[model samples]
Target: MSKTALIFWGGWEGHTPARSANIVKEMLAGHGFDITLEQGTSVLTGSDISQFDLIVPMVTMSTIEKPELENLVAAVRGGTGLAGFHGTMGDSFRNETEYQFMVGGQWVSHPGNIIDYRIDIAKPDDPIVAGIGGFAYRSEQYYMHVDPSNEVLATTTFSGEHFETIAGVVMPVVWKRRYGKGRVFYSALGHTADEFDVPQMKTIFERGALWASR
Candidate 1:
């Protein structure tokens, strides 16, 4: 059966959310998802969110109103899966604790803005990450405040080169968790749509998105 998705994008321009939303829209469409792309969070209230099997929010650092926010939270709690990557998901809604709780993590810093790093596959057996090996990566090495209950799939180590205080710190790069009855997945990869050019990065996110919608 084909699944449906609602992808609402555009918050901070630096995130290039429009490009991100279009990219994921294509990716999911190829996987048999019926996608609806919209700008701004207002789409949440305008649409019957519960009918969609998945919801992808590509908005970063944006304020969502109480009604819109509550509507989204309610829809997901009733089993609409949520999934996204990088700041679009992790760094979104700084003031909403409930949103962060549902996401399982919030971005704190990227120690080294954009540098070469390596990702370690923590759960090689998990379907979302299985068969994918750790590879050299170039992106913001995200250091986040994460939910301890998350099922971490991948991680990165801080060398103290950028932020000396947190040297040797291991941070999650990809994770998935349950939000009520909905499956939630997030990755600190894809700082911009360009990052998807990396096969490993793209594969991880695509597979993870499918898993999230499960």
Candidate 2:
């Protein structure tokens, strides 16, 4: 059977959630996955989730309705893969406690957007990170609050540009976690559509999603 992917996008307009979802849908389609795109959290209800092989949430700054949120959680924990990027996955939910737990991280700050930083592909032997030549890009250097048990796949070193001097830290750029029987993968890149289109970032996302789905 052909694999299926579901994507729900919308929340705060500042992050351009729709554009992000489109990029993901296009990528997944190219790889032979049937894609379903929804615009709001309300769509999380239908029974169609069980038919999907993966779930991608692009929501970034809104309190999800409990029923809808629970359905999404159930879909994921029931073995449907979950994949997303940056605030759309983590660092979202202004104060929603459960949402943070599900995503496994929170974006605390980004002192300066695109201030020059270097992400080291930590899991160079892993298919997702392997062969990805380390490259520097001008984008938000995300400072994330990561879950302790997650398998960190990549990290970024402080480049001494804007916040590096004071906030000397190696932050997680890519990671994977297990939620019940399902797999979850997140990439802390994609601050913009252009960033999502970058060759390295696209490779990381595509590979990560395929890995998470397994």
- TM per prediction: 0.98, 0.93
TM-score, prediction 2: 0.93
For all candidates, what are the clash counts? Answer: 0, 2
lDDT of each: 0.92, 0.83
Error of 2 at 64 (Å): 0.2
Candidate 2: C-alpha lDDT: 0.83
lDDT string, candidate 2, 92-181, tens digits: 566776666777788887877657777887888988889986788778888878888888889987655665465567888899889887
